[model samples]
Target: MPQIPPPQQQVTHVNPQTLEELPAPVMQQIQPITPGQVRSARSAMEDMSAAAKTSPLTPIPRISSQTVSLSAGASIPQVRVFPNQATTVTFSDATGHPWVLGAPPYNSSPCATGGELCVGYIPGSAVFTIQPTNAYASGNITVLLKGLATPVIINVKGAEPSVKSKTVDVDYRLDLRIPKRSPDTPVYTATPEKKISLYDKQLQSVLDGIPPEDAQRLKLKNAPGSTKVWQIGDELYVRSNMQLQDEFEKTLSAIDGTHVYVLPATPVLTFSVNGQARDVEVELN
Candidate 1:
């Protein structure tokens, strides 16, 4: 014998003052949904929910333009360093050339260090490159720039073991500045901006080995094979094959199977392979 169904519950909005259910409002329009549409939405959501724990675990660096300015009389700030990655410090004159020389090309002191932080640069140029030789390297370095009133001190340290966002501990690029350029410094013409295709400006930048200034690097914990990801504004730039089922706005086809696709930005990105959803794996490029 068939079982009887339970009574259904009716939900209605009520007015606080009257404590009575308000009259049901008439529907303006009836939006239609086919059975297939409902199933597709539910399947998509389930795929994402299946691997929440395997999503990106590290905060990826977005391609950024603003430099961390080092000013005089400011407290020494620690710069994150990583083994095998070089952190570069550069001081360019108003002309954009290394400002290590004076009106007559003279400098007072070279880079001085006393730690496992290996520091090196051109003898007279105002660019210093540093690499941490030890995994737990912790030390400081002082530099006396030419014509500067005071020396610059940099505190270096190892990656913290307890930080979730520690993937960004990879080497950082540094830009140094002086209070003012000397009076006798001559003005030089600024270099023209490198021309990039208007259609593929952002993707082209990555291929050129320099991402656009405003692009942010997103760290992907499980990027698809050989795929890289970046975020520019609301768009997610992907360097991978075009075997994608989801809709994408733009793409750059490459002779190699790997290509760049502009996809919708989401907290987590998943790639569909053989009807199965897989999370993308990535690292700092």
Candidate 2:
């Protein structure tokens, strides 16, 4: 109560050395980034990511439309190789830039027939060689390129010499009669003229020459005379008569219809035989 009578002032004491030595707090300056600068930095990062995701270059090969044909029991057919024999495929990128290709494996199909046909390609080569095991039968040889969907089809033909024959009876009327009053008698006799020989190769050639559309309308028939004919709808007939004159006429008519065309006697494809060299034009799909 005695101290409350007057307001008392309190004095605080500070050390002079501590106050004098204490340093003032320093303010640090921080630079703020603008919206434009932030946008530019993000764009640069996106560009770098796109470059990292780019794919390597790849090349494609070229092939020809005409197929190669091989004969049964024949030596291996030599194929004309692509230029440089590099076996490197060439392809253009989305940027229209061309690139060379690395080596790839090949695949081949077995002969459709029971026989085996040797088929293969050399490393870095587009040309495929063919060799047949036997002359048993004919079939198609298929070759596949790795990474490609389409296949190369090579035809193999068997040229074995075979003749199929048939015989029929022919009747010729004789003028001689036994008695003056005896009724006329009819006699039937078989003749060599009725026999026909069918050549296998000739028949195959005719069938192969027929157009797909016309072939669907034709059917082979076995007649009494051993003669074969392409019968069309009962009304139309394309006969293979043994007579030379008739045969010539029939062949001409068949070719004129645009349904049949004669193939080479040796049945060769575009390439030459006997190790002849030829330039191959190939276009890849």
TM-score of each: 0.36, 0.19
Best model number under lDDT: 1
Error of 2 at 22 (Å): 99
Each prediction's whole-model lDDT (CA): 0.54, 0.29
How far residue 224's Cα lies from its native spot in candidate 1, in Å, is 33
Note the clash tally of each candidate.
14, 2
The model with the greatest TM-score is 1
Q: Could you list the CA RMSD of all candidates, in the order they appear?
A: 26.1, 28.9
* Candidate 2, pairs of clashing residues: 62-284, 87-124
In candidate 2, what are the lDDT values of residues 92-179, reduced to their tens digit?
2111112112233232324344445444445543344444444333455444433333333434443223233222111111011010
Worst-scoring 10-residue span by lDDT in model 2: 173-182
